[model samples]
Target: MTQLKTLFFAVTTAALAGCAATPRKYDDESSRALNLARAGGVYDQDLRDSPDGTRSYRKGLFTTLLDVASLATSFDAPLRHLSGTQTFMFNATDIMATPDNPSARPSLIGWMPGSLAANQDDAYEHYVTVVDEAITHAAESMSITATKLTDVKTPEIDEHPLMLWSVTSERYDCGKSNCIIAYNIQQPTYWKTPSYVTGREAASYNIAANHPEEYSRLIFRQSGDERTFPVGEFYSAVSADMPPWIVMYFPPNTVFQDGEPLTYPVLYEQGQQLMFKEPNHE
Candidate 1:
């Protein structure tokens, strides 16, 4: 939905607290929660959708941390009733390491009937995911690999299983004007490389040098030098439940405004990973 539409929904929903005459006070807390709920829909979708979101994820848009209270206070709802690491934690039994076996190709965790029995007392001890051998392989594909360390630094979350991977020092140019792109990295967190580099920096001297507007990638590698993800050549191979789609590559350079292209640059690739985004709100 466009911003205007979302605003309309929020305003309408917010206004409903009024009875025939008096209205409930809108609180800052509730308004804040509503905003979070809205933002959560957008970011969470980035991780779960193919190029677009499934209906379950979409249906969740209107729901927030609280319903009546949010309206009473005009606060954005919390993303969940459960807060802290609990929301980030996934059942340990349901997750596993990638490359099921190094000797065999990796696949997501399989269905096991007895894994978590009802009323099982020991079920809540911990949550876990096997380390990313897939991303390890992906890193190797691009000739970037981490050194052996005593501890692996992973993004902490309510985790079933997590995988994070992206290219380092990579350069891609999207000429689209005021373009907003979506991308997903299986790993838990990403760090943009090339210390202090920004989207404008890439646009000024990197692959996008010829085009202008604004474009950027997130959690890019930290290397001072530029590298390409070679994502176009890589595939998940394992995520059976893969979203309907994933971002592939950004077109060389193109800019758009008002749903129209303003400037253009030729690209061998059509655009950065294809995205199924909601219509822009005016």
Candidate 2:
């Protein structure tokens, strides 16, 4: 935990000092062509699972002592060593809609899930279903008809007002603990690839619009007999380039004392509370 905090501090300092590089400029024709070429797949596996990896700790005297105690008593190994480091995997899909066209409608690409742990597949699927419902509801809030994309791949939306909807989710099991944490995030980016380029300078080279960007995460921990709530800001518009919808149903920075089914309302609350806790959250 101390190491994690130190790493977070370093990253925050770098970002605050303007260490990020500027994006290279592309010609108008090239920009449009590049975006279209990259947007073919229903699922961008690389983007969805950006920081997908594992982190482990070197055994120390404290952990060694605990291991010995576990062998002599009925108590199990400490939770930190048993499931301290986490390996995260995500499943994501895309949807496209042409809201500007009077006769146009929304269409989902096929549900192509990435790799996930075998033990957590069932829970992950349930969580995906809940998120799918949320995405559909979000579209309806914007006044559009939505449909699940099945038995299909990329859809053709080259020359139209496009809105791409995407979602990703993960589930974490709290062994011998009171709460289970489910992590999920969605960033919906769209380009108005209309027949003509708008007069705006930025739009002259690329598509442009303002939309919500959001991330929803939940984490559970156990310390003695006390329950520990998660802390962080789950949703934010970090960049104007990527716009996500208002996925505020799940409140961030929350804890559930009882073992209840991880439903939408629960997620909504958890999502809202997570926003302020993690300064390093991307």
Candidate 3:
């Protein structure tokens, strides 16, 4: 009788743990639509169908306990609302950094149930503040100036070649130009790593051969629409005492504008009207 009670308690605890660690899924239809329209239906199918996709998780008792343990440690994770850290290389362009700006800000906390639940007590204003602060800091780190433009809308912006955007998280939007220069990292707050890192190499999936120790893995991709793309090389910040943020790196002279090889090097141009060029270049 005592053994039965112990077994039941253990089972219940494990179940609860799994539930708590699991991230809530939200309607990703908009994201899917964007991807399908830009990247194609086949690539979207690969992500949805593959076992190593971002959504796939290892099931069973061991995985459950591991997830529970991870959740405990993850409570102290910085930027709890965001899955990972990102760095933007905006070149003094007008940055529309709002969540609605799909090109500038690919993903949002409200889009994820698990992310929202973690900060349920906080007001919506708090989320906006945090996001704004993050974007500002990211720009500063690269010695680039990012002026937040509240009046401008994202779609109105023209495609600029110098804009080379990168992220190290689960999802990314390549914007209208159909160029992708991003990588994937395991979510700092979640037990599971993103699928792009774990999934097998296929069309639109090329794992980084020499990813650093700090990151789980990295993948670089050029979207289905063939355009003049930049050659991005990955590097890690060497610091003994760094913050827990998952930092993404992009070097200058790599991103180009149109077919012309850059006579001047710059990155992270904001909108169509706000563009970046070297002082001498026309």
Candidate 4:
């Protein structure tokens, strides 16, 4: 009995000593910041199970670790890089309208003299050219075929305007072992109304108009052995009335960094907190 007690005490002491020997440390301020950023108890909820009947807790943990490592090293570190060719589709829809009654022309409350050149006509024309160039550039850069820009139809001045674009690209590269495809769409504010007339309202309007450009870097990744793994989709309607919409979809098991998989829950949680809120979006 004495020998058994001694053996148990020895084992417990060794375990405690082992735990004390492995001290947790942060290399720098950036590492500490990253740790704090991800440790906000936001991801404490149960992770949604993947289609393969596996939970992605490990993937989430690894992603947090990779984020910390990236911050410690370089902020410009590429989220992902593929050596083989990739394909993407780009589609945009815009509704054009002109006031039929001269007296009922849309009123411009805050039009400045210097910005007159960017009137509705000029804005529409520029939007067309810019979207066209953007699609062409994306296709060329990703080495994929894209559908020609589709101009659906024009509406009357009183009718609500709509602008939406979608892209779908699929290909296998990197020694033909891995396959990847990305789809993204944006629906910008396309209507003019007097509801945004107050100073605060106008300011909010301008910010919402420009939100997409600011939040475009939010990317999600998933991984799978077969290229045909299920794709994950995310969409947001910022406001109920005349709200801007953004949608993105990608295959499962997509990784932003080596060995770090991006999951839907992580992206959705981050996006909901960041994009749809007050201070963050403002």
Compare the candidates by TM-score and give the number of the best one.
4
Q: Candidate 2: which stretches are off by over 4 Å?
A: 1-118, 154-282
| lDDT per residue (tens digit) for residues 148-217 in model 2 | 4332232223221122232222122223322222223222222222222112122111211111112122
Better candidate number, 1 or 3, judged by lDDT: 3
Give a tens-digit lDDT track for model 1, residues 52-155: 21221233322332121122122112212433222222111112211111111111111112233232222212111112343345446545432222232333
Best to worst by lDDT, what's the order?
Answer: 4, 3, 2, 1
TM-score of every candidate: 0.24, 0.19, 0.23, 0.26
Task: Show where candidate 3 strays beyond 4 Å.
Answer: 1-45, 48-106, 109-122, 153-282
Cα lDDT tens digits for candidate 4, 1-282:
999999997786555433322222332322221111122111122232233322323354434322322331231122134222211111011111111111111111111121323444453344334434544564455554434423433222223222223334464222221222221212223232222122222111111111111111112112233323222222111111111221121112332323443332222221131111112212
TM-score, candidate 2, is 0.19
Ranking by TM-score: 4, 1, 3, 2
| Position 52, candidate 1: lDDT | 24
RMSD of each: 21.6, 21.1, 21.0, 22.2
Assess the local accuracy of residue 20 in candidate 4 as a C-alpha lDDT between 0 and 100: 21
